[model samples]
Target: MGRAWILCKKMFSLTLVFNALLTIACCVGILAGFYWYYSGWNPFAPYLVNGNLLWFAIAAAAINIFPSALLGRKLHTGRFLFHHYFYGFLVMASAVIYVVLFTSVPLTTIFLVNNTSPEVNVGRFFLLGGLTLLLDDLPDVSKRIESGLNHIKAGANRMRKVIVAAQVVTGAFSLYIFAAVCAAMLTIPEWVTPANLILVFTVLITGVTAFIFVKRKAWNNLIVNGEENSH
Candidate 1:
């Protein structure tokens, strides 16, 4: 009775809306940015439409809605809260400020500061946003944030074989996230150009998407199945 009640309550709650609006945007931005870059090399190149993509992914990831969901989950589960989200915010804030105010070191303009060049400055906000997800992982203290894919794995198996197959496929998306980011991260940030902008955007968005995807998926399971802990 208790389990059923919890599931029913969460199923149609604002949680689902918040999940899509706030958290999924993180992943969608990453996917879209990768799509922009992958109009050739990646598999989905031919399938997705072209977008005059903007650079708001970094800011959205930094905003409280994104981290509040991730860190809020950690806090609820008795994990280290302050270091992860607070530092995450600071990293993103620094990224925004640097990109807006100090992307190029005027004192060292002779080094290389070509906006038209594909090689970005490499060390500014373009690179800094990568640290948010890295810091979010408090692995020494616990598993840190629980995985959403694992929750699907723990779903009811006795009901049907199809459900098990679905679980496997769903959990596999995590690999897609990893592979997509690896493709982006491997691209050396050397100049400031459209492609380079997208690359840095990809790196930062990956961190945000990965963190939120894990947290949002797990919470979704809790809402839909009332199964918080995976067996």
Candidate 2:
């Protein structure tokens, strides 16, 4: 399982995510950059309103994509509570921004519907809850689900990217393993004799040769054969 999960981008960096100043900087940069890039915005919502399939896909992705990334990472433990809450706050903030700035719905109508507790904005709560669920992937529940989805059924048409992954893993894993072994040889003086070093280099060269051969074989089909990748 560990070997299989080597490909996952856990995003567990504390410096990148947990730092208060860095987080604020990142948020400001993203929002300001996007606003500057597009002077005017049009929420031509469901961009292709004429096409139900496209609209449905867009809506589905908007609601599900974040959850999918979280699910793939499976980051739902006590340690990740900060991420959970932070992302939750982001969702609510986004909803609030939309409501206050762009929503055509009246504030009174949005709030008056809540009878349980007038102080508790039901409208905001509904949107907040939705955003929280959509973003809360609860990754630990299905830690390996991402890898499982990656193992797509192979076919001539679908195998293009998969083949590249296989080839790279084959070559890269070999080099990575050999590099560690070479590093290990230095643990103790005179532990790795000159004879052993020579043998290791010989094996390393052999492995690299195989990697190159497979790479060229791939190029033969990808470039020499003049076949463009599938969209």
Candidate 3:
């Protein structure tokens, strides 16, 4: 059981790191695309920009929802809570803000701008990427948070509740966004651009895989270590 837990931890860590790298790549690609657009020299800009690189970054950040929750459950540590729940909240909150202030708003409104602009989206991309890297690189902070939370009465239970609540809310919001995007695609088939399809399918696959992995691992852990230590 202990070994199994370790294996899960390692896999989770690797996944987080990979996400961080992917986020960085997406950010770089967006920057490059912008440069190419302005300077008109790079051949790759069309591919990167048309690919909806920013959306991919958002999807990458959003996909972390699953692994973050899994790590929170497995570690039951303060660091994981901060990294997964708190930071996760920030990411989703930003998405909500983007939708409300930009995407969902009418172009005639005061807030009107290119919602798809790389300049507009890059900020969130960097924020998400930076946070993921911070989570990966800063173990001491996470451990300290974990220790602090442990010192509080019923901290573990409270933290668990918070994590669960965040996950539920985030999941619902993501679904809502996905549905909205699909509706827009249907309304204007041209909106079903390559990037939109990629984002939808990527999120679908990532969500399903995360669900299966977390459920199977929980079941296996229960069998290996029994209910008492499984938590």
Most TM-score-accurate candidate? 3
Q: Which ten residues in a row have the lowest lDDT in candidate 3?
A: 222-231
The TM-score that candidate 3 achieves is: 0.38
* Candidate 2 residue runs with Cα over 4 Å from true position: 1-49, 59-67, 75-83, 90-134, 137-231
Stretches of model 1 off by over 4 angstroms after superposition:
1-82, 104-231
lDDT of 3 at 191: 67
For model 3, which pairs clash?
Answer: 78-146
Per-model TM values vs. the true structure = 0.27, 0.23, 0.38
| Top lDDT hit | 3
Compose the digit string of candidate 1's lDDT tens values, residues 1-231. 765654444332223223223323334434444555344434222221222222233223333233333333333232244534455456656655555565454423312232423233443333333343333332322442434433433453233244333333333443344344445445533333453344445434334443554445432332323323311
- In Å, residue 27's CA in model 1 sits off its true spot by 10
Query: lDDT of each prediction vs. the true structure?
Result: 0.37, 0.36, 0.44
How many steric clashes between backbone atoms does each model show?
6, 1, 1
Off by over 4 Å in 3: 1-114, 149-180, 193-202, 217-231
Error of 3 at 230 (Å): 21
RMSD of 3: 13.2
**lDDT, model 1, position 58:** 28
